[model samples]
Each structure stands twice: as C-alpha cells, then as structure tokens.
Target: MRVTDLTLGILTLLGGIAIYLSAMNFQAIPGQEYGAGTMPRAVAFVTGLTGLYMIVEAIMSGNRGIGFRFAEWTRSGAALARVATVLLLILGYILVSPIVGFVPTTIVVLVVAMLTLGTRLVPAVIVSVVATIVIQQSFGKLLLVPLPRSDFLSFLW
Candidate 1:
C-alpha cells in the first residue's frame, strides 16, 4: 500500500505528539539533571519537525493523490498475511514477555517474524537466538537494565 506524504505526515505528527505526552510522565531521578523523558522528548521533537516538512512538501508538490492507494501486492493474500502475522507477533511479545522472560519471548518473536518474511527455518532460528542474546547482553549487562527472567530458565541469563 502506498500512502500520500500528507497522510504519513499527519500520522507521524500525531504519533510524535502522543509519544511526547507519554514521555512527560516519566519520573525524574533524584540527582540527575536529565530525566528518562529527555531522549524521547528530543526524538519526538525531531519527528514532529520531519512530519511538518513532509506535509509542506506534499502540499507544494501538488501531486498528492488520494490519502492512500493500494498497490498490486496488496491483492496478494500471502503479503497481507505476512503483515498481519508480524503485527500479531509484536502484540504477542508484549503480552507474553513478562511471563516467559525477555530472551525466550524475543527469540520466538524474531524467529516467527523472519520466517513470515520468507527466511529459511534454520537461519531464522540461528539469527533469532544470536540477536536475542546480543540484545539481552546489551540491555541487561551493558546498559544495566533488568529484563524479566523466567524462573524455569534462569540459567539462560
């Protein structure tokens, strides 16, 4: 599916606004000058600016077709299924991660997403496992973020 720049810009602008609003709720650390919302607010500002630029450009170009147009690929059930599966996988990960642990949840989500995108099974599993470990190490060790751990597989962490 092809969306007009105006449509995308509007959506992006709204998303940025929502992110900014949500980030405002982040609590400030006692001795820190910059709080958790700092980075997100900055990113939201930039995203909002980018969306504004896109909207202006779209209007200036005067070639903005209907808000969105469907491409030939949209008619393919397989293509639609792939998109839907990815969305569902993300939702599943969010709901299941806390219960099953970040490592297993992320690995499963990645493997399914890769396979849905036509990656081979073995390669998908390998990449998913490797990527999950990298992410776990980066967040849990390097960044000092505590990820949920599964009681059944605590050794994995």
Candidate 2:
C-alpha cells in the first residue's frame, strides 16, 4: 500500500511525542550539566517538529486522505522477491545473532545480500568483512556499546 506523507507524518509525530515523554523519566547523571536523557529528548523534539512540518505541507498541498494502492505496489514479482529476501535476512540475523555472535551474523547477512545482488565473491566477502569490522569498532570501541559475543567464540574478540 502507498502511504501518504500525511499518514506517516502523523505517526512520526505520535512516536516522537511518546519517545520524548518516556525519555523524560530518565535520571540526570551526577555532576553532569547535560543529563542522560538530553540527547533522546532533543532527538524526539527534532523528529516531532519535522513531522509536524511535513503534515502542514501535506495539508497545504490539499492532500487530505491517505492513498492506498495495494495492487499497484505488488505488480512486480522480482521487486517483491528482493524486498522479501532482505526482510527475511534481517529476521534471520535477529534470530541467529545471539547464537553465532553479532559479527559473524552481520558478515553472513551482508555477504549473502551482496552475492544475491550479483556482486563478485571476493568483493562481496571483502566488503562484508570490512563493513562488519567498521561497525564493530564504531559501536564497541568508540561508542562503548557491547556487541553480542558467541559463547563458543567469545575468545576471538
């Protein structure tokens, strides 16, 4: 189905409001000028304002109701197949990450996706590994966020 900007804007606005409200409950860090909730609240406010602007633009442009064109969206089988493949791959990653570890799961998903999209084997593997390393380093080292480690292979990291 084709969802209009108006509908998406409304949903975004609601989500932003909810996020902002929930983030307000977070406690400020001791002796810190900016609290832990500051970033989340700022992000929510920006999202909400952006959505509100979109809603206003949609209304001014005379687009009132949402347009739902299901048939028009599903006419191409190949397009649908690609979309489904990516979605299923994401679901697979989520389901298997804890078992195989986050790094391996991400690399597998990326390599498979690249190969399915007609990339060469060497390039696909290289790109996937590089991307995975970059992401792991960025989140784990730079951001101090912990990634899932496989029980069997936790020593590798």
Candidate 3:
C-alpha cells in the first residue's frame, strides 16, 4: 500500500514528537553542555521540520484523493512471502537471542537471511560470522554495551 504524503508527514511529525519527549528523560551529562538526548533531540527537530515541509507541499499540490492506495505488490504471493519471511526472521531473532547469545544468534540469522535472499552458502557463512563479530565488538566493546554471552563461547569474550 502507498500512503499519501500528508498521512506520512503526519506520522513522521508524531514520531518526531514522541522521540523528542522520550529523549527529554535522558539524564544530563556531568560538566557537559550536551547530554545523550542532544543528538536525538536534534534529529527529531529535523524530522519534525521535514514532516511539516511535506505536509505543506502536499496541501499546496491539491491532490486530495485518499490517505492510502493499494499497490500491485500486495497481490503478489512471492512478494508477500518475502515480507513475511523477514518479519518472522526478526521475531525469531528477538525470541532466541537471549537464550542462544548475540554472536551465535546473529550469525545464524544473518546466514539464513542471506541464503533465503539467494546468496551462496560459503559467502553467507563467511559474511555472517564476520558481521556478527564486528557487530558484537562494536556494541559490546567500543560502545561499552553488554551483549548476551554464551558460556561455550567464552573465548570470544
């Protein structure tokens, strides 16, 4: 389905408002002018401005038909299946990650996603492993965020 610019603009504006409100709750950084919320607030401000511009442009265009339109892809079974597969994959990742640990779960999910999207097994495996490690290191080490860990994979830690 295709949404009209006005509808999308309104949604974006609401999302920006929500983000800005949530960011307001972030604690201020000690001796720092900007806290963690600073970047989020800035991004939300830009998003809100963009949404307002879209809303204005849509209003000025004089194209007031419907808020949304059904697209041809909605009738395609293959297209729908691909979308469902992606969604199911995300659900599976969310459900399994804590139990299986981030590295293994991510690698498995990536490999399956790549294979389903027609990538060769060897390349998918290689890419999944490398990408998982990079993501783990980036978030767990560089960002100082703790990721789910497995006792069996303690060597990686």
Candidate 4:
C-alpha cells in the first residue's frame, strides 16, 4: 500500500504551482506591506521547496524511478469495495446536492459513507447528523454563504 515519495513530491510541486498562479490574480492592498496574496504566495513557495526536497529524499533512499505500483485491489475484494463505495458516495452527493439541498444531502452522504466504511450504526448516525449540522452552519451562517435550496423545497426557503 506504500506509494512512491517521488510521485507525492511531483504532485506537491504541481499543487504549489497552481497555488502560486491563483495567488497572482489576487488584488494587492494599497497601503498594506503584505497583500491578501502574500501569505498564500509564501506558502506556495514553501510547498514548492518541500516538494523538491521530497523528490531528492526519495532519490537518496535508493529507490529508482517513478513506477510505484498500487496495492493490488484484485487480490483484496474488501479494499476495492471500500474504494468503490466512497467514489459512488461522492458521485451521489454531487448529483443530489442541488436537488435536495446541501444540508439533507450532506447528512445522507456522511451516513452512507460511514456505514460503507464499517462504522457502527448508532455512532454513524450520530456523527453524520452532527457533522451535517456543523457543516451547514459553518458554510451557511458563519461564512454568510447561501446553500442551494431545491425548487421542491422552495416553500421552506
């Protein structure tokens, strides 16, 4: 199940480039020495450096080239099942969110995900419900972002 550090480093380097590119578009503050983009750009620079170091470390570990194989899912049905279930859950969430509203959709996804991962029924239900509420509040209330309300639920909205 161990992945190659070189692959991770390459991915991290790409991520850093993305962050830096996005940060470049951020508007700079007129009076402030550091603009909104400064900190993010700095982080991106660090990520790039760290990724480079990881690549070098991987090489120094005597591991040759990039072809690290994944754990054989064909040999482990349970592992494959778990991965498939999570992917399906994510797909369902995307398709359902705008139809049922974010709160209800998130609740269902979290519950299903926990159950699929073999969590106990009672704990899964409790955690799913709590997590759903917290996420809703965090995005909807604290962040002042309005969640999508289904047309079917328009009356409630």
Per-candidate clashes, comma-separated: 0, 0, 0, 0
Give residue 88's lDDT in candidate 4 (0 to 100).
88
Q: What is residue 79's positional error in candidate 3, in angstroms?
A: 1.8
Q: How big is the positional error of residue 85 in model 1, measured in Å on the Cα after superposition?
A: 1.2
True lDDT of residue 75, candidate 4: 69
Better of 2 and 3 by lDDT: 3
- What candidate 4 gets wrong by more than 4 Å, as runs, is 72-74, 93-157
Model 4 error, position 147 (Å): 13
Q: Which runs of model 2 end up more than 4 angstroms from their true locations?
A: 3-73, 151-156
Q: Write the per-residue lDDT of candidate 2 for residues 24-88, one digit (tens) a residue.
A: 87888888767979999999999999889989998999887775556664898877887898999
Clashes of 4: 0
Q: lDDT: which is higher, 1 or 4?
A: 1
The lDDT of model 3 is 0.86
Judging by lDDT, tell me the better candidate of 3 and 4: 3
- Tell me how far candidate 2 lies from the true structure as C-alpha RMSD in angstroms: 7.4
lDDT of the candidates, in the order given: 0.86, 0.85, 0.86, 0.81
Q: For residues 1-157, could you state the per-residue lDDT of candidate 1 as single tens digits?
A: 7898899988888888988999998877778867888999999999889888888888889956547889998899999999899889989988999888898898889999998888999999999988988888889879988898876446656
Tens-digit lDDT track for model 4 on 1-157? 6558898888889889999999997877897767889989999999999989888898899764675676767468888888888998899988888778887787788988898888999999999988877776688668877886555424433
For residue 129, what is the lDDT in candidate 1?
Answer: 86
Task: List the candidates ranked by lDDT, beginning with the highest.
Answer: 1, 3, 2, 4
